[model samples]
Target: MKKSPRRTFIRDTAIAATGFFIVPRHTLGRGFVAPSDKLNIAGIGVGGKAEVNLPFAWNNGSDNIAALCDVDDRMAVKARARWPKAPYYKDYRVLLEKEQKNIDAVIITTPDHMHAVQALAAMQLGKHVYLEKPLTHDIYEARTLTKAAEKYRVVTQMGNQGSSGDDTRLVETWIQSGVIGEVKKVHVWTNRPTWPQGVPVPKGSFNVPAELDWDLWLGTAPQRDYNPAFLPAIWRGWSDYGTGSLGDMGCHFIDVPYRALKLGYPVSVECNVGSVYTGFFQEAIYYESYPPSSITYIQFPARGEMPPVEMIWYDGGMKPPRPAELQPEEQMGELDGGIIFEGSTGKLMAGLFGRKPTLLPLSKMASATLPKSAFEFVENGSDGHQQQWVKACKKGYGAYTSSSFDKSG
Candidate 1:
């Protein structure tokens, strides 16, 4: 008969992120009682990025850490120590099977390759999921998870915290409001590959680490011998195991233009990669890993009043040419990466996650009439993203999330 306290927090949280409210199911249809006021979340990969994600998802103990899962116990130390009582499992399937009734939701921060399987397994059990970004390994997996989330009618959100940021919605509003004119081109670049990339696979027969289940860690991916080089968050460059820098950061950098402009799918795409030559004119060919850098060109078709948008992605330190409109004192994006939008009237640019958005040439703002961001909800750090999902799950399905499976897919 009344709004749940969790639902009220979710509404206020949504107002911070999108200046909107998450209407509880009771208001729209039959009342739906959530699993609990405090969601019981299980982490599939409780290491690497999970170290940061788990705590944010926990949200100051408002939620319960019902269970934990990770192939490498070494990677699970902090999580296990934090929630010493939550059941831990090295295999996700076993975790799901054993703790299905206990966990109301799952936070899957596993690598890209394992996201689809781990997410679907839990969603099939009707558990809400907060999956890490680059939603799935590829298009097929993305589509599968997208369709499954809709079919199962579960709460879903990707790990792109920027989506809940004021800048994200600001960029969306600015572009959609035509302040940047009709965006015809977008350039996104990231300085990733901080790990071993463009190098030959490590060659050696090392005993599998006692802390890791080599076979379990390689779930759904091609079986391979375990090597220290592939982990500790260094798997992004491997073609077999990771999606390179693009996957590592594309979802964050490119997501702005894609959402702002509604670029559904690319019509055509081409890519070129930098070469690593062992000697002059002698290229060191390595097929197992992504090249040191790459340039990708994707062409998207026009929709409604919008024209065809040309999106270019550069990684491994490559970046688009500096816009002449930018003054000498100004910088394009931050050291990590940035995104630039080219429209008919002027250009719009922002650093990673579309933060610190600026119109080209510092002088433009004086004459330009900018629309108000209209966003009342603002989140600090990356807590808003996961908390949005937690609240959405508490409110039941149909609650709003910026990067749901359908949008991310």
Candidate 2:
């Protein structure tokens, strides 16, 4: 059979649109080339959480890591072992300057303070970015990144993996189904184990790691002496380097109820802590890092068709009061992190990102039926949330929730 020129043109157009190309078996074999095809990814911070997430991006099929950047040479060496072909750099700007054209997107898993600067630089160069959550160190940075992402029209995904979970959608469906009719209030809590919480500042000077480029690591943050306790995961407890427990887990823990209730921006935010201590460390540490503990209350106004919602955010050692409806056997196990949606009819409680949710008031749970208009839970079936972003990057599909631009600001 002979193919018409028009058919050949249409096929090629489809291939191009999909960022894929089919080559003859004899030439390049029988495989389709992805659009945004053959992405060369780079890692901005290759320690802590980035180590876990970077691999997922590679496993997603559309990306291949091309560069790794970290202020610590030890961490960079660890990353290099994973992708020996990818070059390493102490400063991300150097990597961006040298490999900007070679890289398709940059995964920024750096500290919250650095997220805005690094992400803005990447997006300015027309590269897509995947930023870790709580988006930025401050509200201003969050808004700035959102605007930059929009201006560049780049694909962006925030590191809130729970947003892409099947359970999350189920909770959304449950809410929309009126299983918990007209959610009026929500109490979200997490007992984030302390890594550096409540620990007073080191009174003595310490030796800095020779492998660490301390200046680069500090970046826009105020300069400080090296302290072993402040590095690695402990940084989350500090205000300068991190966002405390709420900033650390709030995005993930609170995301479900926020999304389920279609929460708009909070009208006001106030913090009530046990005590305030004055020192160089207090300025460096977030309120959640202190002992005796604290709680932040965020109130959001009802907008459009939604009712006003009161959200009580608890963390740095707090737990929700056990619901009265649960039997001894039905009591939730180890309330590490979860949300309870209190509605007029019944209550819906679920773990972070909607994992293993159970309706309260067992009678209501038994009597209530799935809504007729409810959408079937369709698993996207990609490896995970990061993979979903890579797939979206290749296919030009809009970002899923946990999206960088949409969720960050």
Candidate 3:
């Protein structure tokens, strides 16, 4: 069969223009199917969580994996196998430079520190972006990326899947319905650091693996020996490359309440962290590493009629006191952790990703009769988060996505 003229133009014009293919409306004549309008997507850091994220974009049925970039060849093995036709690059800079016109969007699942630079570069070139969550490593980067998205007028979505889930909407409904009246306190906890933390930085330098680029792995972080602890996975525990447990999972657990309560920035924050043993009568303070455990208290000012909200975050095998209403045999949250909202009238709780929410005493949950709120649901549910971005991309900027940079950042 002869190729659709539109498809040929999309490919040829993309390269000829030098960057960002301008789709001509006149050429999209009759019989040119909508589903055939594939968005060429390039992936930066196509491994680890990207193992799942890249697939999410592919399953959306609107993406062509045009390019893949990763510093570690060993890490990129699975992704390389999945899209063997897509050219691979050891440095994202080279990939973006060489394939600028070939891709319409970019998916960034790199380490927290590298997200902003990679994303900013892609957005500057007019490519839509799907960034992994927490939005960025620091507040400044988050703010910058948020503004860039607006200035560039490109569709953007943070990879917080729960933001697109029914749980946030359900909680939003219950809060709006006053089932959990005037929530003043929220407790969110997680069991992370499943990697080593609160320890001295490894002293000896290890040989960099042949398959990995040591300098690229360190990207924005300061120079350091190529320790195994920093490679492949354990980087989450380091302050230089990772954001601790809070940075790693904060977007996932905190997103629901943040969306449900229509929250704003915190007014103040205070924290207490568990200690690491180092010497006799001395607790270790590895400023380079995240604490073994911590309790962070952040207070948000009241919004209009809403009461002031005190949100506490706990991580590293620590959790808030179990709710008095919960039975002794019942688990406070699942093995990983959970969230609890304490309100004037009652309490509501849910596990990670805002799953299995329940009202206190079980009876309150059973007795409460409520209609589903008008909040729109993602067509395929939580898993459709990536697909949501895909739709918004095809529809252009300002398209509805649950966790756009304006909301998530």
Q: How big is the positional error of residue 284 in model 2, measured in Å on the Cα after superposition?
A: 15
- Model 1 whole-model lDDT (C-alpha atoms): 0.82
Residues 1-409 of candidate 3 have per-residue lDDT tens digits of: 2222333433432343344323322234211214447877899999888888888888744477889999899889999999999999987767877887678789998888788878887887777889997688899889988988887778899998888888778877787678878999999998886998898888886788899988777766676778887766788788888899888888989887887787899999999999977678887799999999999999999888888999999998889998899888878977888999999988999887788888887667767886586598887768889888887887777788888999888
Best by TM-score: 3
| Candidate 3 Cα RMSD (Å) | 7.2
List runs of model 3 lying over 4 Å from the truth: 1-36, 60-62
Better of 2 and 3 by TM-score: 3
The list of candidate 2 runs beyond 4 A from truth reads 1-36, 60-62, 276-292, 362-367, 372-383, 396-402
Mind giving the per-residue lDDT tens digits that candidate 2 earns over 127-236?
Answer: 77889887998888888788777766678888888887778877888887778778888888877746666666656788888998776777767667777877877777
Compared to the true structure, candidate 3 yields what TM-score? 0.90
**C-alpha RMSD of each candidate structure in angstroms:** 9.2, 11.0, 7.2
Please provide TM-scores, in order, for all candidate models, with all chains considered together: 0.89, 0.84, 0.90
